[model samples]
Target: HGEDDHGVHDGDGPIASDPSWCDVFAAAAKNVIAEVFAHAKTPVETRRQLQKNKMRREAARQTRRTKVVRQTTVTATRDVQLQNHDDHRVTKTVSGGASPFVSAASAMQ
Candidate 1:
């Protein structure tokens, strides 16, 4: 039938209308234009994402470095405090060549 030549007449047909050459060409051109724009912006978007990732990595590395420095500082302070406490202790020799076992604290009492 002539109707079949134009397009299917079935009410349940998937296509609403037959595609003309003009419509096909316009659709293809639109796709090509969109691809061109996307291609042009690809490098800019990639560089932006890379910069963000690098910043995040650098921030994490700085945080880790700060934590280690703080921990080392605290440990060094505690060691110096302990050393100071040990340095305050005093030892003395007894008369008649006795073993030098008496501490300054015991002598004070």
Candidate 2:
């Protein structure tokens, strides 16, 4: 009656005590481990690819930023040069051109 209630018990012994059950369990565990490793490997490779893409995008963005900065710097330099040129022309006209006001003041003196 003790063995009859336990349905897993074969004529020889319990199914848990079978050597074939141990082999089946071991094979199932190995398969699970292999699947885990396979899943792990895919993510690592995907991460590496993602990282490389990120780096490439960053590099491209940096290049574009540098180009913009260079263009702005060139424009600013040109504007400064034009301002200096205009200032120089104004100084020359004030110093070298004869003014009627200056002549009249000198005559009064």
lDDT of each: 0.71, 0.80
Tens digits of lDDT, candidate 1, 1-107: 56555554544343435467558878999999998887677888786886799999999999999999999999999999988765444322343343444444456
Where model 1 places Cα greater than 4 Å from the true spot, the runs are 1-41, 91-109
Tell how far residue 32 is off in model 1, in angstroms. Answer: 31
**Pairs clashing in candidate 2?**
none
Best by lDDT: 2
Error of 2 at 108 (Å): 27
- For model 2, residues 1-109, the per-residue Cα lDDT tens digits are 5746656533567766889998999999999999878757787778788779999999999999999999999999999999999767655665887467555544666
Cα distance off (Å), candidate 1, residue 9: 85
Residue 24 of model 2 has an lDDT of 100
Model 2, which residues run further than 4 Å from truth? Answer: 1-42, 98-109
Among these predicted structures, which one has the highest TM-score? Answer: 2
RMSD for each model, in Å, please? 21.2, 24.8
